[model samples]
Target chain A: MIGYLRDIEKSFPIKDIGKRRQRVLKGISFEIKKGEVLGLVGLNGQGKSTTIKIMLGLLRPDRGDVKIQGHKPGEIDTLRHIAYLPENPWFFDNLNAKEFLYFIANLRQIDKERLKQEVEEMIKRVGLSGNEKKVIRKYSKGMVQRLGLAQAFLGDADFIILDEPLSGLDPEGRKMAKDLIKGHKKKQKTVFFTSHILEDIEQMADRVLIMNRGRIIKEVHRADLYNKTLEQVFIETIEHDRNN
Target chain B: MIEIIKLTLKEAKREKGFYAGLILLFLSLICYFIVESFAMFEPEKVMAVYALSSVEGLSIILLFFLIFSFLSQDLNKKGIEYMLTLPIKRRDYILGRFFGINISVFILAIISTFIYMLLHLLMFGVCPFAFLIQLILLMALVLMLSSLPFLLITASKRPTLIAFLVFFIYVIGINLDDAVRFLSTRHGREIPVVSRALLKISYYIFPNFSFFDVKIPIAYKLSFSTMHIVFALLYGILYTFFILLFSIMLFQNKEIK
Candidate 1:
């Protein structure tokens, strides 16, 4: 397994005078295999993002273990192989797109000689060719997402975790994003991404996990995807879970 | 760590607070020159006092504002998530931000000090070496003082609350000795043993910010020992190191939602 979460549980403390904790994930468990594109699909607050966070080691699980390639998440060695694009990517507004990518590359310890060339290539690859000099604050929502995607792919990471990678893209931008993920697949990289668009999961995912109320209520494989559309399966699964 | 430091310095340079500090320094110099031209009494001394106080006040305010605002924005807006997701360790992030802000503060202090020195030379035809040394020491103290905000932000996420705490601590730290002396002497024999002990503990608890206020000594050309400067330097280094360590501890466990 490239990464796996075993009986992971998480809760957030409500900021009231009296302490109150809201359990967000209730013992969710899953695994990712190498070179596989795993899609996590769910409603707004069904712990999809939380699971991703735990996998990335951004949030510690209250119970159970999370490991990346046998090492704990957020470990230096483990993190080196992983790249993440947050749902709403926040960057240093002072830096331009190219500068921001360079910053991430430098943090990843990329060679100085290759840094410039790699950043430029990623910028062009993400369709941000001419906007490389534009400061992040000036970029539109879609441009920021492109820049985010550009940085996430900068280091040739073995594992890519994207949270709503298609959130702000227009139709053309979405196609570009899909193509980018396909390119990652061609490289045999393990990808775990969350998306609201079922078509994205249908087109890109090797396996899709449908989560509801903090549980993985259903799983759909690529073979099953040939039989039914992801949207149909998703709606039916969620509605079925709700009815029960 | 170096990359983070570089990025942070780049970010700090673009902040309005940094520019505002520089502009304030320029305006203060202009005001000092205007005041010097219309001096009715002890013009040089007045200029010296005005220069040192203005530089100290402006630098401290700018440092506090910049560190607080930057850290708050990073945490609240989730900018930190991008950095934390990298291979860098959490402690490296804290140390990088610490050094980055300190370097910017040092640069600001140097520029202000240069302006002060230039003004002093133009007005008095002589710049005292002792005053220069005192100003450098004060800048070191300011750098140490700026570390508080990083630790504060790590401890609490509320900027308003952190600002209030910072202001309160500054006020208390500078007057700690006076408050301690007053409490100890005013009650002398009448005070309870526990209260006296508490007062004694409070005296040592807050950073003795008065140790860094060499403005009065510099202004009056009073003689001070080299040992005092060395001790103050050591104190600032030790204090900053421990605070940074504690900040790393807090930040390591901080959950990003």
Candidate 2:
């Protein structure tokens, strides 16, 4: 298993001085196998992002356990093989594309000798070669998303986690992102991404997990999805869960 | 960790505040010069006192905002998510930012010192070595004071709240000793015993910034013992380390959501 989250429960204190709390993730559990493309789908306010954060150790779980590559989440050694691109990705606006990529590459401890060559190649791969000198603040939203993709794919991480990776991209950008994700899969690397676009999830994911109000309502394999559209299944699942 | 430090330094260079601070420091020095030139008895002494104090004060304020905004901006914008996801220990991230911001503040100090030295050389002839020592001490003081924001940013998310809390700490830290001394005096005997005792305890516990104030000594060119200078620098380093440790602890458990 590349990642495991078992019986995870999390809640946040709603008020400053009291124990009043709001539950975000309740008894969530899942696992990602090597080279599997797992897509998480959920409505707004559901615990999809929270679950991802828990798995990444960005947010501590109130109960249960999580491990990434046989190590606890956020472990330095474990992170060496994982790369994450957050939802609505924000980067250091002061840095140009090349400089920002270099920063991430250095942090990833990429071979110093290959760092320059690899960063340049990734920039070109992300179609950001011509605008490498422009500071990120001057880049358009689509450009920033491309830069986000560049950093995520840099360092040759074995597992790539993307939250809303397709949100800001135009048609061409979305197509590029899809191809890049496919590229990761072709290389026998695992990918865990979340998106509201059901068609993209259906096309890209080996399996799709549906979450509703802090619980996973259904898990559908791509083979099982052949008879029905994922959108139809998703609606049926959400409506059934709501009526319960 | 070095990457984070380098990133912060580059970000600091790109910020408009860095250049604005440079301009403000020079403008404030000019104002001090003009005001001190009117002093009939000892203009250079007055100028040195006001100029050094102004630079120290300006640098502290600048450092406070720079350090606070750097972390707080990342927090607010969710930029920290990208950072924490990297194969980095949380402690390394905190330390890297602290060192980076501290270095930038020192750069500002260097520039201020150079200007002070130049102005002194042109107008007053051969700046006193004692004042140079005092400037170094002043840099240490700035380092100590500026570190509070690193701790405060981790503790609270609200910028205004952090600002007010840091301002409160700065005030109490700088004045605690003075407050305790005043309360112990005959004229201050009417103050409540509980308040006096609390102030005294705080004076002993909190980092005493007043001890680092060497403006009067710089003005008079008063000789300081080696032990005194060493103790002040050590105090600054120790306090900064304490604050940084606390920030790392808080940040280790912080939820980026």
Best by DockQ: 2
* Model 2 lDDT, full chain set: 0.84
User: What digit string (tens of lDDT, one per residue) describes model 1 on residues B19-38?
Assistant: 98989888888888788888
Superposed model 1: Cα runs more than 4 Å off: A16-19, B184-199
lDDT of 2 by residue, A1-244 (tens): 7878889899988987799999988898888999889999999989988888877888889999998888988778888899998888889988899999988898888999999999999988888889999999999988999999999999879899999999889998899899999999999999999999999999999999999989888999999976899999999999999999
Docking class for candidate 2? high
Over the full model, what C-alpha lDDT does candidate 1 score relative to the true structure? 0.83
Docking category for candidate 1?
high
Whose TM-score is greatest here? 2
Clashes per prediction?
0, 0
Give candidate 2 regions above 4 Å deviation.
none
State TM-scores per candidate.
Answer: 0.95, 0.96
